[model samples]
Target: MTKSEKTQIIESLTIEFKESNAIAVCDYKGLSVKDLESFRVAVRPLGIKVQVVKNTLASIALKNAGADGLEFRDTNIFIWGEDQISLAKAISKFAENSAGKFVIKMGFFEGNVVDTKHIELVSKMPSRDELLGMLLSVWTGPARYFVTALDNLRKQKEEN
Candidate 1:
């Protein structure tokens, strides 16, 4: 690629990385184009982006975005998003479903380099929406139980 094109790519990636809070690097050595595209479609709704970028350019962009410490090698695909938990969850799920073809390397979470284990841990945690749903359930539990009890009391009185 020419100097200007490379510069443009780096600048765009830097902006993307700056907006994203989590970035997961994966080795997509044997994945087919269709598979990768499907994966991209699946995560697109979650505001995640998937791209295969040159390691040098990606490194420069990442560094420029203030995230460093990941060593990129071989064929890599980057998955980044604003929601750290969503990013971790999506990549982890894709890695699992892709069998051995797609492998999760390391990641940048909140501008700090994190290991695969840390990423996995983050994936297992509930997402923001899931947490909100759980909180709503907890908040309504008492009222639901009270209604159920009142209904049962009315039914017993009618039987008597």
Candidate 2:
């Protein structure tokens, strides 16, 4: 690609990196076109973007963007955008279900570098919405129990 195009790509990538909640690096060496597309389709609906980038260009972009620790030496596919936990789950699930065809290299979450173990941990994390729902359920459960007990007590008082 031309210098201008490369510059533009770096600028655009920098913007994405800044906006992303997390970034996952993966190896897509043996993946077929169909499988790659399938991966894209799976993550896209969850608001995650999968990008195949040259390691050199990625390094340049990372350096320019001041994201130095995010560098990878091997062929890297960068996954970044919204819903980090779901993205991690998607990657972990794809790795688990794809017979090892897709391999996760590492990740960057909340400005911290994450290894495979961390990625697995992240995959197990509840999504933001799920956590919110759980919080709501926890809050409502006590109130519901209190109301039930009050209703039962009122019925006993009326019968007596």
**Per-residue lDDT of candidate 1, residues 26-125 (tens digit):** 9998999999999999999999999999999999999999997889989999999999999899988988998799999999998689999999999999
**What is residue 159's positional error in candidate 1, in angstroms?**
2.7
Worst 10 residues of 2 by lDDT: 62-71
Tens-digit lDDT string for candidate 2 (18-86): 888788899877788899889899888788999898887877776665566865776678988767799
Model 2 RMSD in angstroms: 1.8
What lDDT score is found at residue 36 in candidate 2?
A: 86
Off by over 4 Å in 1: none
For each candidate, the alpha-carbon lDDT, in order, equals: 0.95, 0.85
Error of 2 at 130 (Å): 1.8
Native-to-model Cα distance after best TM-score fit, residue 60 in candidate 2, in Å? 1.0
Among the numbered candidates, top TM-score falls to: 1
In candidate 1, position 29 carries an lDDT of 86
